[model samples]
Target: MSDINVNHILNQMRSLSLQAAGKPVQETGGSTDFSSLLQQSLASVNETQQRAGRMVDAFESGASNISLAEVMVESQKANVSFQATLQVRNKLVEAYKDVMNMPM
Candidate 1:
């Protein structure tokens, strides 16, 4: 949830719906390509995980400015994002397998 934007996801779904209905999608600043969106999402998740790790390291090193509550919150955020990414990967693999097994 930390790296995931619900609004962005909803917008993408809306765009896809428009495309399926043979309507033009409006121009937007964000990349609409699937690969680009996926890359950006993965990068966000990576950043979140890295940030959490750094915070944990700093706290373990006796950093006075860092608080246990902040570290825990960041760590949980990272874990949730990672879990979501893993689930997405699993679904993508399943989809690929299904497409491959579709016979002519």
Candidate 2:
């Protein structure tokens, strides 16, 4: 990958890490709204999935224009993100169930 693309990806990853760590991207920014953060994370996951789907479609369509390495990387990213989301959902469901079963 070109230096620019690599730098962009690294920057994005850094931003994501900061968000996940409950650190604002800017000093002037305050606490992030939970709903907004959840929505943004979901949107990012959806976008990754869409990109992976497009890569698969391109490959199946006999388009050699897209590099195999790029496709693989995107696919792996989508898979990992999906798995993380699924795990989070599972944990949330379990917590809710436990709460509901608790004595008042």
Candidate 3:
């Protein structure tokens, strides 16, 4: 098999991160809500995981024409996305704690 392009994947992820960051808040007659953005992101990640699970189930049950390689790749993608989200959450929590502990 040909070698995987790590740089390409990293660049793609960086581009996506930038895009998400640069999204303008909807003018719903109010300020931007970070909670809603976080919820949307978490929902998206959950959907990805659910899709991967469905693909694996279909592949294992032989109920579809999906290949084992495709299932594995999707599974890995879901896992990596979860890990990245978890890392971001960890950093956010750490920052929150630091701020809370700062002297007033």
Candidate 4:
């Protein structure tokens, strides 16, 4: 899928979460809440992880006739998504630490 499609999915997830939480939709918004953004990112990462797991299982179980190349591509996609999630988590933690250290 295109990068725009991925971004669209993320935005939809964020909007759903905000609506569920009874928060006003941020129209003409200055900025989004970092924590909500991170949560949506994590959700997407989890989806990728699950898809990878399924691909591996299919390869091992002889249930799917999918090619090795397809399996490998799915695995790589999961790996890259996981690494991206890790980086986002690290940055969020660092930002939190900085905020905590600041004088109130």
Model 3 C-alpha lDDT per residue in residues 39-88, reported as the tens digit of each score = 87788789889999999899889966899889999999899879989999
Name the best candidate (by TM-score).
Answer: 1
Question: After TM-score superposition, what is the CA distance of residue 96 in candidate 4 from its true location, in Å?
Answer: 1.3
- Deviation from native of the Cα of residue 10 in model 1, angstroms: 4.9
Error of 1 at 102 (Å): 0.6
Stronger candidate by lDDT (1 vs 4): 1
Ranking by TM-score: 1, 3, 2, 4
TM-score of 4: 0.62
- Pairs of colliding residues, candidate 4: none
Pick by TM-score: 2 or 4, better one: 2
TM-score of each: 0.73, 0.68, 0.70, 0.62
Poorest 10 consecutive residues of model 4 by lDDT? 25-34
What does the lDDT come to for candidate 1?
0.87
Off by over 4 Å in 1: 1-31
Instruction: Give the winner by lDDT.
Output: 1
Q: What's the true lDDT of residue 50 in model 4?
A: 93
What is the alpha-carbon lDDT of model 2 when measured against the actual structure? Answer: 0.80
lDDT of 3: 0.80
* 2 against 4, candidate with superior lDDT: 2
lDDT of 1 by residue, 1-104 (tens): 49997768878885895586466777565546788768967897899899999999999999999999999999999999899999999999999999999998
How does candidate 3 fare on TM-score? 0.70
